[model samples]
Target: MVLLEMSIVPLGQGESVSQYVARCVEIIERSGLSYELHAMGTIVEGELGQVLDLMRQCIEEVAKSANRVTCTAKIDYRQGVTGGIRSKVASVREKLGRVAGPN
Candidate 1:
């Protein structure tokens, strides 16, 4: 599995871009892939192709509504690991001797 942290922004969409963010989140949700939305970006877990395709979809959708769009993505892939979205965080908290909060 692959873990991808992605942020899609529609440029010149005024100061608040919550609506655009919401639209991207909606696309991610519809993909049926496991995902978590954070303040700066969203993390999604799936195969590399699936995740990349989803990212493309978001960019395409946002471009239709804005003059320009910017997207950033960071991907992590482990040879034999899955569920890094939650497990990666849990691993860190465990080493710190603390239980993870809501995943």
Candidate 2:
């Protein structure tokens, strides 16, 4: 599975962008992909094409409102691997012998 971190910034919208960000997230969720909303961006887990397509959809949705939009994404494509969003962080927490809080 490919792990994607996406942050969409809608330029000229306003100081607060939560509403626009939420719209982009909705597009991703509708794709039925596994994802996590974070403080700065969203983490998505799926196949490479799925993630890329979702990114395109998100950008399109955001563009409907704002003329200038920035879609920043980082993809981790691991063959024969999955659950990177949680597992990657968990691995570090484990190495530190830390117990995570309830999700």
| TM-score winner | 1
Candidate lDDT values, in order? 0.90, 0.88
TM-scores, one per candidate: 0.94, 0.93
- What tens digits encode model 2's per-residue C-alpha lDDT throughout 1-103? 9999999988998889899889988888788899999899998999998998888888888899989999888989999988888888888888888886444
Clash statistics: count for each candidate: 0, 0
Local accuracy of candidate 1 as per-residue lDDT tens digits, 48-81: 9999999999999889999899998999987789
lDDT of 2 at 60: 87
The true-versus-predicted C-alpha distance at residue 12 of model 1, in Å, is 1.2
